[model samples]
Target: MTYSASMAVQRLFPTDEGHDLLDLTREVVAKELRPKVDAAEAAAALGEEFPTDIFRILGRAGLLSLPHPEEFGGGGQPYEVYLQVVEEIASAWMSVAVGVSVHSLTAFPVTTFGSPAQREALLPGMLSGHQLGAYGLSEPLAGSDVAAMTTRATRDGAGDDGAGDDGATDDPAYRIRGRKAWISHAGHADYYTTFARTSDARGRGISCFIVPGDAPGLSFGAPEKKMGLHCDTVREVIYEDVPVDAARRIGDEGQGMPIALAALDAGRLGIAAAATGLAQSALDVAVAYAKEREQFGRAIASNQGLAFLIADLEAAVLGARAAYLFAARLKDAGRPYGKEAAVAKLLATDAAMRVTTDAIQVLGGAGYTQDFPVERYFREAKVTQIFEGTNQIQRLVISRHALG
Candidate 1:
């Protein structure tokens, strides 16, 4: 019924600041996010209501910008510490955790690749949580093939079209026309960091733009009925002659692929941490159930079969945590972490898929229903492997890195 990672997980973070931040994170997740999860998820599954209120609570708490600079209203923490916060929150509620991670990913382009003027003008509100962002990269045909995207951003004459300054700018603009599928915060975010083709070259033609939610011709499809993470809504972001100011562009033309891959290198680690937390939560529920549930005059956990399974699940959770933590440390230390990020995502998400399913086995028939949260965890675990680049794509990244 409750969620907590092992206390020993703190040993991974040696600094006092890490401990304090994670302590605050645990308190927030337990007090605010966990209690409302079931009902919120149920409601979201039936309608288009994403948890804007809970999201604002996190933003106000400064959890929304953990890895960004303090100058831009971020927490200014290292990814190593930020990711643990993600894991902790995820143990309580995967949807909120995913939402936080996606929001962070949405900010990456502007913060990391944007021009100085763009950062000064936009990053403050974005980092401060006055605005929420959705990353628009994956299209219906381009989920993993970044080169296959069809979204295009063409230079516009001027802002006379009047989208209310059009992402709050007066610079030359671009008319973006394309649909991004499987966007995490579609219909609910304040801005969209859109990627579109500016040339015909597969790898060199793509460009990134910060498209406002109110930009003309920007529309969202109805929410998709996904099998898990119900409260983290996903929908299509359609841009039809949507005018985005040139000032809102993140970087030079034809730089989107590299920028996107760079962001994914970090985002994958966030997802890896989240998947570990989900597995950890499922493990906790299974352990508690096994310890208390009686079976033929003995607790189910007393049986070697169930106990070893639980033990293995625990090991998998620990391994997953270690994998993501390793990648996060690499990122925090300012080392090249792309390959390690892929490895961590591959290990953690696959481990989550296995661990949550095994947790259900420990619960037997009781695990199949909504009475326990493990079923939800099981469903949630599945998508982690599919998104942030599929586990298949992670393998490709890893293999290429290793061979090179």
Candidate 2:
């Protein structure tokens, strides 16, 4: 699991701190992540246990807050620099990379739209990495179409839900009741960044909140049985009359979709970077195996066909890395990058799938078995195509941008 990071990827940082940040990331990954990746993933596959300690390790290194404002416990790194760090983490251990991405995703609403007081109160804890966050958006009935979500957050006042007598003394709160499916860190998160409908108006009716994990009536379904990323947990987040303080709401009512979309645009880049890293890891394995494994009097890597396949896979990995970085750069510049983000997610994830599959092909029988990591890579690659808006949805986003 000695992963040589991409040397060909050209990174231009506006500050020397950016370079130092990446160096810190690599040192942490090599020291803390790579050594235990396989065993952790294997345990996770059977036990459904998430590596909370690893996330804390990342948080302690200031890895979790790289892109936010330093005033709010962030590292103040740009998206371009932050994403490269993510790519490096994913190259070593994808589950931790994904965990970091999802945690960052959950913090977006508070970072971007929360009140000054809310930011002062919440951002420090969330960005610290000691407290993980979960996003509650997609339900079983509503996946890609977030507007179709049925989760409702009702304003609980002195009259209703039994908050009595001293009306003037009580702070405002809302009772959220709903189920969120496919939520990462569902049971374990310290907070849930939830989107729930506050009115009957389709997409515009929704609102966002930071619901405390230990709140009364907050619960989670059992962890999902998944294909890969076992060290990351996915489960249904359930809220039954969960009372969240009004101060916890991130944005104004009816502004949830925009906040969600903004976070999603950045999140798409994260997935793209992570997927590219996975591809890089798979390609590395394929190359190392090809060099050592022999057939018919010499190394199988000597065969022109196998060598060509390896070369093509390397090219694809590099392309996937470039695609995500391009989108990350646009975001770093404060440019409109929704379309580019979609394009990166589509291309990079698809490339991961293809490259991992081809890696398996090159490894032949050994790749198909658990003895080599290629099979696990193949399993993991499939989900990247499905989540963060499927590749098909990415094409739709790209097409709309193209049309306009």
Candidate 3:
């Protein structure tokens, strides 16, 4: 079953424009993404290959900037609407959907915490759909414990004229020196939203900076060999004495922890939505195969035992979708949704893992082969429980909120 047929899942939009945007997204998925995803993913798994053209196509279609403010080249769509678009994309291509989520996370600091001047100068390009971004928060030693990060950004000498190596003038620059690990689009992004320590105040010492991709001393390591979502391109981003103008900093010094946490809340929702889509696709394939595959001169779907399993998969996919949509609605209404986001991420990703695994079982011997997509879906679903904070971290967030 192709993604287009999987659109049988009913959806509700807050506005006519939202409905149209989804229609556009599905059309693009059918025409552009689904056609190329298998070939592209296979090529990427063998060597270095990033879907630069596909991103450009999405950018030009205005899909990349849907959640940002309209005043600065964004579509100004609500979180609920933007997330559905992400889910639709994920149904067709999981790697591209994850890329969209990571790109949105990279812009979260500037959109949510940047000063007026920063927004005016940077947002147009960032949200213009012409640029891609990477989030630089995790490090080799500090994946979950963000405060343990050793990346340092020191203020330049007082006597020096605040001039960048590129001859751009911005007073009071800072030199960043560190490495970020497990970064998506590490070598291909137009800019990196990076966090580094500036003081000795533990969590209060860090700050955020937007470093241009062309910045001197910014380099990337070879991509990590991963089990799935190979086209997403995970890598290490090395910042060796990279200079950034203070003007590029999103929030004030000592505010990075809050900024990063807030961004994760939103990022978690993205992951949840994507996971739901993936599960839906898996369920769709399983159902289609069950109806066609035969046993004892009858379709296997006629067997009550197999049919019950299909029903459970359907229930899990719908439950996951409801979980994320509820969280998205909370975020759209300007309410505190951190705990809900964590819950959604935990539920949806766990559902994805279960649904995809069952989908493979539904196909039996055929599923274990590359001839069917369930094997690939199983591989992709495993990582959803790991990234955007592990399901373990989600439980911690939910417990803290409940206790408080």
Q: List the residue pairs that clash in candidate 1.
A: none
Best by lDDT: 3
Q: Give all candidates' CA lDDT scores.
A: 0.86, 0.86, 0.90
Candidate 1 vs candidate 3, TM-score winner: 3
Choose 1 or 2, whichever is better by TM-score: 1
Q: After superposition on all CA atoms, how large is the RMSD of candidate 1? A: 2.7
Arranged by TM-score, best first: 3, 1, 2
Cα deviation of 20, candidate 2, in Å:
1.7
Worst 10 residues of 1 by lDDT: 159-168
lDDT of 2 by residue, 1-404 (tens): 34364434566777898888877888898889988988999999888778888988999999998998899899888888888889889888888898889989999888888777778888999988689998888999999988899999998874222122211225446889989999998898999999999998866899888888898998888999998999889999888999877677777778899999999999999999999988988898888888888898898999999999988888888788788888888887888899999989998999999999998998899999998888988888899998889898899999999998
**Native-to-model Cα distance after best TM-score fit, residue 287 in candidate 1, in Å:** 0.7
Q: In model 2, state the lDDT of residue 136.
A: 89
Best by TM-score: 3
